[model samples]
Target: MQFVNSKAFAQGLDETDPLRSFRSQFFFPKVRPDAEYLYLCGNSLGLQPRSTRTMINEELDDWAKYGVEGHVEAKRPWIAYHENLTKMMAKIVGAKPHEVVCMNSLTVNLHLMMVSFYRPEGKRRQILIEAGAFPSDQYAVASQVRFHGFDPNTDILELAPREGEDTLRTEDILSYINEHGEKVALIMLGGVNYLSGQAYDMVAITKKGHEKGCTVGFDLAHAAGNITLELHDWNVDFAVWCTYKYLNSGPGGVAAAFVHERNLDKDLPRFEGWWGHNKERRFKMEAEFDPIPFSVEAWQLSTPPIFLLASLRASLKLFDQAGMKSIRAKSKTLTSYLEFLVEDTFGSRDWIITPRAPSERGAQLSFRIPKDGHGVLEALRNRGVICDFREPNIIRAAPAPLYNSYPPVPA
Candidate 1:
């Protein structure tokens, strides 16, 4: 679809958007008494769903009335609450219900998946990762290597772009994997990079890593719900993500993980907790660790925080209603329109580091700022454009399919 740069054209698109009514379901930040903020920060933290309070209050009321009995007596039983979420969560990630479980936050789950999947030994101890990975992921991989008695400097392969480029090229990645794949124990990447907003070709990458005899996985913090995924069909080894962004869970909300069914009950080492033990035999307080067969719940280490799960459930319900296909349909259009607007306004004066092709990105358009653009974000903030500035010189704007429309032109 050809995109126009005029506000009238943008409003026309908004008026006909299939997902337009979804904008009313979220609570946007109010930057002033005069008007609402044009929240373009879903890549960071999504606008809160207005139903969050009612959902939380249901849990509160259950706790207030049922006391300890709420564990079994709440409208949604606490013992089985996480189970209630698996089907929808799996659909969002394109996995089987048993392969996915909503659990710990992103970094924590990454470490957990590494425990089972990143079994480096002999000549294959190195982890292949992006150079500018989210810092927590870098730290997580470093510590995992150190924990296994390897020098992180030697064990972590930080893949970088061609000189003066901002994003990794697919050909470069495949070529690197072909050359050094045998020595690498794992290939972990953010499915959609947080900074450049480039969505990797997971299917091709996963196949390449596996052919090279490496465990292939992704951190879906920015990918889950933002794009279509097929962890099961892609034969992806594992993945982890935080739900606060595109999933629209609250701040620091519960995250989730996906493990291929082929790996379940394979005698892998995992950090065990009572919750991971077989539910039928759990109450007996058996000393033996009997895991839930064929389920990713085997990796869970503790009782889930039901409040966080409930918040995510609220968002998942919306996802269930909107279907991922519809979500992706609107997302491509919204992000393409966003890219067109940014380029029309700034032209070549500012750089758009994100991939221009809609197929290679999600809902975000990241613009590299000029040296004098330091105060630009602040001005946008004051004018009610809610975007985020990354260190050095990047301004990230995400027109979330759920709650964002095209920004009105600057006067």
Candidate 2:
């Protein structure tokens, strides 16, 4: 599809977009009394779904009316409320129903998964991760290494890009794995890198990591609702993600985790809680920790917050209706159009630090802006272009497929 540099062309594409109507389901931020901002910050935080209020109110009303009985008597039943979201969440991350569970925040889930998967011993204690990973992941890995009585400087092997490249190459990653994978106990990386917006090849990475006898996992915070995933088929040992960004689950919504069925029944060390015990015997107040066998729910440490799950359920309803294939289809077109306009206007694609191929990225495009990046970001914000800035010299814009249109790109 050859893209023309004109507003009319963009409008024509918008008119033909199958997912165009989804844009109305979200409430956009206002820049003036009557006008809305061109919101392209979905990579940081998604626009709130219009139905979020109604969803939360349902739970609030139930609690007000049912009192303590709401645990078993509410419309969705607070006791099993997380179950209502299991199937939908499983679909988003490409896992079986029993493999996925919505329970805790992202970093918390990361620590939990690490407890079971990151078993370092002897000479194989190093954790291989990206140097430009999200700070939360960096801090989590460092603290985990320290907890295991290893020097983070020596035990955490940081994989960085080559001298002039902005994104990691698949061959370089494979080569790096071959070189140091034997000494690494866990291979953890972001499914879609936050800084560069590059989506890694999970299938290849998982296979290579396993070949070297290492545990593999991904922090899918940016990838879960943004790109195509197959955690089950890819044979990833474990994974975790937050639902706030591309999932449109409101602020600090309930996050989720996935454990392959192969690892579910293993006698791995984990922080156990009553919520993870056998549901049938849970109310009996038994003394033993009878974990729910062959289920990821065994990893749940406490009762889930239903209000947050309610908010995420509202967004997942839209995903169930739209389907991930359709979501990803529109995302590629939206992101490609954004890239084209940015390059056509800026004179070259050199301004873009994100990978050029659609398969290598998702809905976001990170640009290497001029020296005064913060000033440029403020200018864009003042002009109603609602994108965000990373530190130093990068400006990130995401044309979210769920609530964005082609017209905004060429506007």
Candidate 3:
């Protein structure tokens, strides 16, 4: 592909982008009335949609007008509210409607899924995970091992990148799986490494895990709205993700869980709540727990926060309109442009730690500074370029294709 200078290229790409106009739909943070910060942090928290306020207001109006009767009398009807979110989410993740549900937070759902699928038996008691998995996931896996009467230190097998390497190679990951697969009961990994922005090959990993009679799951916190996924087609056993990041739900918005249709009726016990009970018989308050017979619905533990669900409903609609394919295309071009700018700015002196191949990453770029990295990040922030700082020496910048513009990449 022929490249253009940063400014011209950004303008040209945005002009040609079919979804470029969607940027006006969001509420960009403006520290100065005349200026907007370059927001490249959607991998951490997405820019809020302008429609979020109106959607949330509608729910508030219903709550005030109908009070408790809002359960059924509200315009969207709180009683059947979560159902409204299913189809869009299913489409985004490439799963059947019955296989996806918006439910508890990411960590909570991970534990619940573990309760059902991480059945430790005989010598097959280990949980295989990436060495630098997200802290929450690491804690969850460790706790599960301890809960099951196993030593976590020994039971949790984390595969680290080879010495002096920055990213994990697919061959290395597969080799670890092949070596430890027979002993592993579960393989839970982040769909995209949060700090490095490396997108794992989920299809190959899932296939290999199943071949060894192990369940496979993903923590798609950074990957959910940033990339294209085919969880069902990949035959992934289960997956969980939070919406606050790329999904653009508000902070701590309810997360989602996915289960392949094949495992919906396997009789594997889960830690359930009344929401997981069959809807028709739930109000009867029966003594026995009879789950709703769907992979995703069966994972719900309580009534989801209606206000948060309202925000997600608005965001998911935006996603459906733009579609993941188009979003990813813009993401690749925009991020590649930013990477080009960064390299051009520092020439051979600065390092871009994120994968150079667009196929291997999402929209985020993790740039490393050999000197005064934190100070440089602060300087960028002072210049009205908003990104994040990781410990040691990396600034993680994500140009959300939906909201970021070209001027900010070099500014």
Candidate 4:
């Protein structure tokens, strides 16, 4: 495919984009009235939709009007509130309604998932993960291994990229699994690498892990809203993600999890709380720890933050209206334009570390600067180009197709 000129390509893509109108629905941040900051940090925190204010207000009004009875009486009754958000989330992640649930923070949910899935026994005690998995995931995995009386240093295997490469090759990942498959208890990988923007092949990785009788899970922190996923079809054992990134839920919003149907009936002991208890018998205060099925709901710990759920509900409605397929189409073209601009302006002088192929990435383009990279990022920030800098050299730019437009890309 021939790449288009930066300015011309962005304009052309915007002209054809079906989801262009959705941009106005969000509240874009303007550090200066004359300039629109190119907010490309959606990989870390998505821009808030203007509609979120109204959604949040409605919940606040309900709280004022009903107080404790709001659980069952308020508009969008809190009693069945989380259930309302479930179907939409399930659709995005490709899972049954029962297979998905919105609840705790990402790390908290990761720990909960490990409780049920990481039951190490016999010789199957090692946990395999990507070398540069997000810090939260690293801590969760290490802690889980140590909790089970295993030495994390020895039992937790982190698969790094090849000697001189910046990204992990699929063959290297597969070979590692083949080498340690028998002794591995779980395979937890970032669906997309946070720094490299490489989208891993979940299907192949999950299949290989399951074949070795090891459970497979994913931290979709950077991948959830940025790309299309088929967690159910891929037969992934479990997965967890926060909605604040691409899902556009507010900061520190509740995260979600998915548990395959096959694990629904299995007696994998979870770190259960009352919310995960069977709904019908939950209020009865039963002593038995009966779970609500292996679907995402089984991981709930306590009451959900209704206000945050309200914001998510509104954002998800927008996602449903726009559809992931169309969003991804625009994402590919827009990011391609940004890549074109980077190469055109800096050429080989600056490194574009993220993969060039759209198939291998989402919307993010992580670029490495030749010298004084931090200063360049600071200069970009001062100039109203809002992107994030990872220590040492990389600057992650996510041209979010949902809220960001073509003009901000080059302005």
Give the number of the best model, judged by lDDT.
2
TM-score of each: 0.97, 0.98, 0.97, 0.96
RMSD after CA superposition, every candidate:
1.4, 1.1, 1.4, 1.5
Which is the winner by TM-score between candidate 1 and candidate 2?
2
* lDDT at residue 54 of model 4 (Cα atoms): 93
- lDDT value, residue 88 of candidate 3: 98
lDDT of 1 at 219: 97
Worst 10 residues of 4 by lDDT: 341-350
Worst-scoring 10-residue span by lDDT in model 1? 402-411
What is the clash tally of candidate 1? 0
lDDT of 3 by residue, 352-407 (tens): 76778998899999877778888988898888888898877878989888887665
lDDT of 4 by residue, 1-411 (tens): 476655676677678778889988987777767656778999988989888989989989999999999988998888679999988998889889998999989999899899999988899999999988888999999999989998999999998988977888888888889888999999999999999899998988998888888899999998888899998999999999999999999899989999998888888777888888887787899988877754557678898889899989889999999988888888898898778766777675247778778888999998886688889988998887888988678889998889877754424
The TM-score measured for candidate 1 stands at 0.97
lDDT of every predicted structure (CA atoms)? 0.90, 0.93, 0.88, 0.87
Off by over 4 Å in 3: 409-411
Put down candidate 2 lDDT per residue, 110-215, tens digits, no spaces. 9999998889999999999998899999999999999999999999998889999999999999999999999999999999999899999999999999999999
What candidate 4 gets wrong by more than 4 Å, as runs, is 6-9, 409-411
TM-score of 3: 0.97
Cα deviation at 85, candidate 4, in Å, is 0.5
